[model samples]
Every structure is written in structure tokens, then in C-alpha cells.
Target chain A: MNIFFFHLMPYGDLDLSYTDKYDSAWVTLPNTYFDRSKGTAIYDRYIGELSLADELGFDGICVNEHHQTAYGLMPAPNLIAGALTRTTKKAKIAILGRALPLVNNPVAIAEEFAMLDQMSGGRIITGFVRGIGSEYFASGIDPTLSHARYYEAHELILRAWTEPGPFRYHGRHYSFDYVNIWPRPVQLPHPPVWIPSQGSIETIEWCAAKERKYTYLQTFSPIELAQKNFDAYRACAEKAGYKAQASQLGWAIPTYVAETDEIARRELQPHIEAFFNKFLRFPIEMRMPPGYSSIASTKMLIERKYAVRASQQTIDTLGDLGMCIYGSAKTVREKLLHHQKEMGIGNLIAMLQIATQPAEQTEKSMRLFAAEVAPYLRANASTAVAAE
Target chain B: MADNVTTETVDVRGLKLKVQQAGSGETILFLHGAGGSNWTGLLDRLATKYRVLLPEHPGFGRSQIPDWMMSVGDLALFYLDFMTASKLDNVHLAGHSLGGWLTAEIAIRNTTKLRSVSLLAPAGIAVEEAPFGDVFLWNHEQSTRAQFHDQALAEKRLTVAPDLDIALQNKSAVARLAWNPRFSNPQLPFWLHRIDKPTLLLWGREDRVIPYACHVPYKNGIAQAQMETIDLCGHAIHNEKPAEAAAVIEKFLSGVKA
Candidate 1:
């Protein structure tokens, strides 16, 4: 199975105070309060690990973009991806996105991605996003036309990447007399397109139609829902007359591995809970801003399931409920394998942010995951490993 | 922070309003932008000379969500009520972003109450040439990139806010009220001519979030307004370049006889 490790490289400050300790925790602490110096140091350390993953023989290293909020410090994952392209020889530098509509020119994306692909000799994976609803409010994009603009911008960018000569792209959101991208991508027909989704139906169906690889960024979900989403995608792929490959599905969840479940639980719980209580406290009303996505995705969590309810228990246990993994290596491996076997997930993106952890410990967790869990599974899924 | 600058809870049409009052000079009441709290850095500067009153708009900050408040105009009128109840006459109004828009709305209706109106990167003007960078779509990087000259500095200044609860709440409320037309009120330009108070149209030249071209419409529309452009600044002029922004405000305020 091809795997990638991603980190938000949160600002390293011990300031998780005004949160509900249990539910709506993620909405309280803003990402803007992260210590830049510490954030950079952590970024350098983890980015080095991402590079080491290449030496350890992982398929790819993932970095993504988020803004304002402290959940993730990466506002421009592309810049980091660009830097990684220069350092790592073997691993693919997957910029899990450049929020397309937020960008003024898709050609710049075409140019940048092509440059990275050329510089890395075809090791770039570009992910395009409509950017989630919070982003729309942060950047002030009209939510009403988000989908339209995303589709148009994506079409323009794809055309710029594929078509040989300067052509014109006249669309609703973007228009240019001549669309010429210099240094066409090293990979013919552009770098491999990876689409990251929060299980939006349109995104799933779109990826299915195009035969593109998709990752269900299992942010706040549990194994059951993750499996359901994969099932949905498989069904969508089948309906589109194509068999969905395991490589086409990627899963990411916040993970912390330690010597014992108790230790892992003790250390990781507070940080994850702090992240939740401080940053995740938003009522559903703001989170699902109108025209942000198709009404389906937002309504599912808001009016339908009562998932966005404000509560301490709900916030604290959210990660444990579905999306977070905290345990001994054996326990974590078992849980990860459960999801893999159930959903046929080939790509697993692990997040390692446990509050106030020394960089050495975080690196220790990464090293353990790399040395023990990864190699064993890579060789054969049938082999029984000690959970001891 | 002053002693009398107390947080008062007022029952405005059944909603509890959080108003931060400080200092003792002229009655200079401040209105905050979308998602802004009274404690934001900009208000700290204004609190020095004037009896600065920073009220978190309804459905924002710690203020109770008003079910009746429907639009930015509703917020403007509510603020007017707040001033009247406090007996704050000869008001020197200063606002940023949506607050600036609300200030313009208030000046048009209750011109007699305002001593002078200073708008910092106001948002009511419409420009068709170069579109404003969408403030909502920006992640921290894109947001700072759109607003600041230096990425590192902007990142440094943007201490991951302690609590985004207010931001989230404000975003939802703003989205609820303005998402239909995307915060650009089409009818607002028609009302600008009615504002007779001495208006200072302060603009940040590098403001991509609300494109600098927006100043053109205001210049053409408002008869009594004068313009001053601040260089190397963006939409959050007061927050991004406060010294320069405050300098512009001081000049504008000094020009008026309060």
C-alpha cells in the first residue's frame, strides 16, 4: 500500500485555555496564535521526516493548505511542496491543494505545478480545491459561485496543462486572450491529479468520472463513516463503468503512537482535545456557510444527524469517535489495518500533533511508525504481527 | 485599559449587547468589522484620547444573537440607538471594513449626531474593473498574502488568535445576512450622496481584499467626502498599518471642529 504522512505543523505554544474541554473544542483556539518560530522549527523537523520517508521507501509525502485557524499552520502547502521537490529525489511531492477559486490566475498554478514536476522530473501531484466554507469567509469569495468558479478554473488549468500551444480560455469566472504555460509538466498531460474531499458527493462522483485518485480526508470521522464514504465512491465508480482501485482511495486521520495505549491516550488526548475545544467550537451555522458547497454535504452534518451539536463530551470524544488514532503501535496498527481491510484504503495520511510534545517525541513517534508498522504491512497483510 | 471603560450589557430589542467603553474626551464610538471583538489592536489606539466605546455588533463577539437584526443597515440603526441611550452627542465615528459601511449608513440617517466620520477601508463601494480579493477564501497564508507586504511579518503579527469562537460566530452571521449577494449591497451606492457629514475616505492602496478601485465610486458619489490614500496597506488598514492609519485619522479629525 502506498502511504503518505501529513502534518499541520501547529504553532508550539501551550495556550489552550478557553475551550469546552470536551465538545466544540476545535472551534475555540484560532490557528493565528501559533508561535511562528516554534512552528518553523517543527516544520523543518517534520519536513525532514517526510524526506526521510522517501529514504525509508514510502510512495509519497503530503502537505496541504489551511488558513487563519490553528488546526493547520500551512497556508501555502505549495511553497513547502516546492521546497520538498528540491530536497527529495524519490518521493512524490503531493501539494494536496492549491485552492483554485481563491487564486486569481489558474495559469500561475499550471506554471508552478509544471515547474515542480520538471524540477522533480515528474514527481508532483496537484490537488485542486473549492476551499472549504471557512476559507470562503476568510478570503471573502462569494459562496454562491464557488462551484461554478472551481469547475471553470479547474477546466482552464487542465486545458493549460494539456493543450500544446497558446489558446484562449473564456469562462464565467476567468478569461484570458492567450493561455500559455511555459515549461509544460514533466509528466505528459500534467502531473497526476489527486482530489481531496470531505466526502462531498459532487467531488466523489467527479473523481469517479475522471478516473482520478481521491482521498477522503477523514478529518472528524470514525472508521464506519470512512468505510461508508469508500463504499459510496466504489458505487460511484461502478456506476461510471470503472473498477475503483485501492490506490484511488486515500485516508488521513490524526494519529499518535506510543509504548502503551495509556501513555498514547494520556499524551495525545489533551492536545487533540485542546485542538478540538479551542478551535472546533463553531456552531454549524457558520461552518456550513451557504453556497460554500452543494447543500448536500453541509445539510448532512447540520440538520440531518445533529452532529454539529455544541457539547464538551462531543468535542472531546470527536477524534476518538472516528478520525483520531491513539494507542500502542500494535493497537494503532490493528486499528489502521481494520480500516484498510474494510475499505480497501491504500493510502493512509497520519497526523502527529500531541500538545506541548517535545520535537524528539514527535520524531520518535514518526520513527516508530516508519520502522515497525509501515514495513511489516508493506511486505504482506496476511503475516501476523505481535501487538505486545 | 481605563477604569470606567466597563463592559455593559444592554437589552437592545431583547438581545444583550456587549459594549466596551473607555477614556474621557469627545464621544468617539467605534464600530468593528465582521468577526471583530472590542479588544482588537485597532481599538487600543483609539481608546487613548477619546471616550472610546467599542461595541461588538449583534451576532458577533460576545453579544447575544439578535433574531430581529437582518442586515448591516439594521446594525447601523441599533448602534444609533446605543449612542442615543448613552447620550453620546457630537459623535466622531470611526469604522473598519463592514464597520465603515455601517458608519456610512448611520451618517446618512443621523447626520446631526456625527461630528466627523472617518472610514478606514470602507466596503460599500462597487467596482467592476478589478475585483476585490475574496477575504473569505483566504487561508492564513493567502489572507496575509492578499493583505500584507511582507509574509513573515504578517505571519508573526497574526498570533494564532486565542479564541476563534467569535470569528466563527461572526462569520456565520455575516454569511447568513450577506451570502445571497456576497456582502455587496447593490442599493448602497444610491444612499452615499445623502451623507452630509465631513467624511474621510481613507483607503489602503494595496488593499486587494476590497480592491483600491472602490474609492472611485465613493469619490464620485459622496459630495462632502475627501479622500486620503495610505500606501503599503490592505483591507485591515487600522490593524495592518495602525500608525499610518491613526495618522490619517488624526489629520481628518483635526480638520473638523468638534
Candidate 2:
């Protein structure tokens, strides 16, 4: 029942130019076209505000990674997590992920992540990602080989941490003559590997097999899709001979707390639309990159309900359907409880940056959620209700 | 065309392709980058040494976009289909960016067709700290500002001005076929290991679109890849520094029997 706040660190400019026609503006332009100097100040303010979340007794703090685009300035989310470790004492620093395979020398990853774990005193909940489509275009790595590369890289990184290295690895994808790593992790097998995905069946199967933490980062996915995915994971976990724990699966959802759902939705929609259209647009090639997913997935993306529905919907509708949760404290609680009952996901990863709405509004939403809704859930906590 | 060189329109499966064929050594198939035609200047250099065949990919210059085609995987598979139809086996394949990535994809699925593979600033592996620049969002000024180290060259390359419409048309055609999200898989990035080919990765040290350090993920994931970094280049290494890139290719090719 712990609530964690997430931010993509969106660029916001209050001034709307005379020519700035909201509806007709092509969202594909660079975010730098808008003033970005305030990002540092705003992030500092955001950090300060969310820091109070820990003081206010909220569970954990979360940060993530994206590059080049202004969607999320956290190209190195671990850096932010590292800062948070120094800033706050108790709240868990959830680096929702590092794009595991995108890193060349995973030993560095092992070293860095282990350092983060130690710095935080074992409070690091590591989320591993293959990154996303734009990453393929950005990294010069073929998307076709993403899945295998990710798995292999993850294995290498894990081994670097756990195995008394200097062991040569002759993997199909990655090979090294020497496998010795310094600064082996303090945690027995490395900090928990939290995987937040769109619930790709391959990812679900992989996570289940490894018994790692799996969270669905399908903010744009529908409730039904989330349910289906969580169900599949549970089924896979059960078939693999283990009863699934709520801590094992999570959902990264956009959330805004207000006096009422109507107020929250109305205030959040425009910024939500702007964020989605500008930063989240995916090209078809990048979306399915060759061999990143299977032919069946490619076919499903083109033919299935989820895929067709995902592609056709504009950013606004998609966000409404997939991204945020906007409501009164009671409504928020009800929805969360419902998600828990229906989907069985224990972790509730909330987007504190719910649409690049005004700073005051965002702060207000966080304060209200922390003050009102969080207590109700904590009181009714059925699972081990500590902040991850 | 040169006296010894011959260009012909050849049928490889259902694809009607214009190919430049020359030389008499090992066969090398050249795949062009986005917005490129078969007779790219880089391909011309390769044609002198090997029996090089540069086929116009469907939806590229003069090649019709096929009805059955959908994803890049389809395009990748079609290359294999093209090889089968051409009765070519054990050919060295070289591709740049999108083409290089597609080459890797095809080689991963069927390494038997390739003598070896070379990727010049190839796009596929995901790298943190450094990521490939977004080509879709770049306008002339922004693209220039974002990419090249030298501003004068950036200005020249950035100004698609007079030919903006044609450039847009070409880009749109590619988008119609390949535009997904950021040239990535939203789900996973793990297929690079599936490749069994002896791969050569060439990168530009100053590539703003995709960085030299970005080669780390590929180096980690592809067991047989040997990497080389070139200077004074961006994403388009073959275009910006062709001689160095081509020399790297030649060395990689020479190291192998092909």
C-alpha cells in the first residue's frame, strides 16, 4: 500500500506565444524550442517538495531514464537516485530502471549499481529495462537483437555481481576474456531486480523464471490490458511452482490527487496530451524493431486489439486510457483497492508529475495524496506494507 | 557506367530491383541507409574490388513499396528471399544505420548467407549515458546544431531547403514503412546475441546522432564483433568520412577470406 512518486522532468513554459495555437501546434518540435533553463530550478523545487513526502511519511521515491528528448531529463536515473540517497534518509530510492543491455561494460553497471545499493544501505530497488524504441535509434544498436542482448547483458551483470568474477564469459552475444569485477555488491545476490515493462509475454516469462520483481510500465495501456498482463504473470509464476507475491509485480501509473476526479482530470488533460504527443510518439519500426519482439508480437501489434487500439488513439485518449489516475482521496483509494483486488499488483508507482501542469497544482496534488489517500491504504495494508 | 561495369534491372523474387554488378572476386551485397538509392557513393567504392550488388530496397528510389510488406523484419526477411532468388551464398554484407541494423537482423536469423557482416554507425543496441539523436525531430538548423562539430558543414547538410518537399516525400515514404517509435522496441532490447556472424562495428567518435561509446552494448552483446572508431564523423560515417569508413570495411573484409 506504499505510494511512490515519479517525474519525467517535463519542460514547461508559461508564456504562450501569440502564434502558439495550442490545437494546431506540431508537437514533434524539440523541447529546447521552449525555455529549459528553469528545469534545474523546477527539479530542485520538485525534489524539495517530494522530499517532504518522506517526512510526510510517504513510502518511496522513484526516478527513471530517457535521453536526447526533454521528456525525462534523467538520462542517468541512477545519478538522481544517488542524489536522493544523500538528500533523504529513509525513503527507498527506486531507480525504476537502467536500460541494462544498452550499457557496454556491464561490469561498470554492476559496480555502479552495487555502489548505489551500498550508498543507500541496501535501500536500492533496481529496475532493469531494455530501454525503449527511440533508444535503438539513439544507441546505434539494432532493435532486432534487443531481447537477446538484454537477457544476455542482464545475465552478465548479475554474474559480475554474484559470481566471484575473473571468470571468462563465452556468451552467444557478449564475451570477455576476463570476468573479474571489483566492489562486489553488499547484497547477497545484488539488490532486487525490479522489472517494469508493458508486460511483454517474453519479459513476463523471463521474470517469472528468474523470480525477479516485475512491474508493468504500461502507463498508456488500458486497465483490461494491465489486468490481462498481471494475470498472465501470476499464471506463469504459479505454473513455475511459486505463489506470486504482491511485492513481485507493480504498476507505473500517472496519478493526480484533487478535491474531486473531475477537477483533477480537467486540470491534467492538456499537459497530459502535450507530454504524450511531444515525447512519447513512436515510429512503427522503432516500436517493433526487428527481432526485439517476435513475428507473433509484430502480427499482434498490427492486428490485435491492443496493438491497433494503441496505435490509432491520439496521445490524449491514450493517456486517459493508459496513463493517469485523477480523483478525490476516496476515489483514489477505491481505484487502488480495486486494482489490488482485481489485478493483485501490490506496488503503486505514482507519477507525481501528472502532466506538465502548473507547479503549484502538481505540488498540491502530491500534498493532498500524501495527506489524504496514503493513510487509508497504509492502514488497510494486507501485504508487507513497507516502501520499496 | 564504366566499360567493365554493368548495371541491370534484375528480378529477385517478386522484387524488381536495379543493381550495379561488377568485379569478379567474393560477392558483397551493399544495403543503403535511409533516403538512399542503390548507386550510393559508398557502394561505388566497394564495387571496384568485389562482385558488388547494390539493390534498391522496396520504397527507396525507384523501388515500389510492396503491398505485402509491413515491418522492418519483413524487409529483413526479404533480403534473405532476395539472396535465395539471386542464388547467391556466402556473401559479405555491409549496411549503414538502418541498413546496417537490418543487415544484423537478417544475419542473426541466417548467418549461413553471410561471409561476414560490417555495420557502419549501425542502429540496434541500446546504450545509456549516450543515446542516438532523434533524426525525426531535427529541422535544418536544429539538425545542424545537434549533429556536426563544424557549423559550416552542418549548415550545408542541414539546409534541405529547396529540396525540402522532395526530402519530406522521401522521409514520409520511409516513415510509412518504418516509423515506429524511436527506432526501438518498446518492449525489449535482446536480439543482438542471436547473431552468429563475425561482425565489424565502425563508429564515428563525434557521432552526435549515435555516439562512439554507444558501441559498448553491441560489444557486450555480440560475441564476435570487433569495433573501430573513426574521427570527424556523425551518424552518417559513410557520407561524412567515406575513405576511412571504407578502409575500415576493407580491413575487416581482408581479415576474413572474403
lDDT of predicted model 2: 0.69
Candidate 2 segments whose C-alpha is farther than 4 A from its true place: A14-31, A34-36, A210-218, A285-288, A299-322, A381-388, B1-258
The deviation in Å at residue A371 for candidate 1 is 1.4
DockQ of 1: 0.06
CA RMSD for every model?
A: 14.1, 12.9
iRMSD value for model 1: 7.0
Worst 10 residues of 1 chain A by lDDT: A379-388
Off by more than 4 A, model 1: A18-40, A210-220, A295-297, A304-310, A313-320, A354-356, A382-388, B1-258
Best-fitting candidate, scored by DockQ: 1
Looking at candidate 1, what is the lDDT of residue A324? 80
Interface RMSD of each: 7.0, 10.2
Q: Taking chain A by itself, what TM-score does each prediction score?
A: 0.88, 0.87
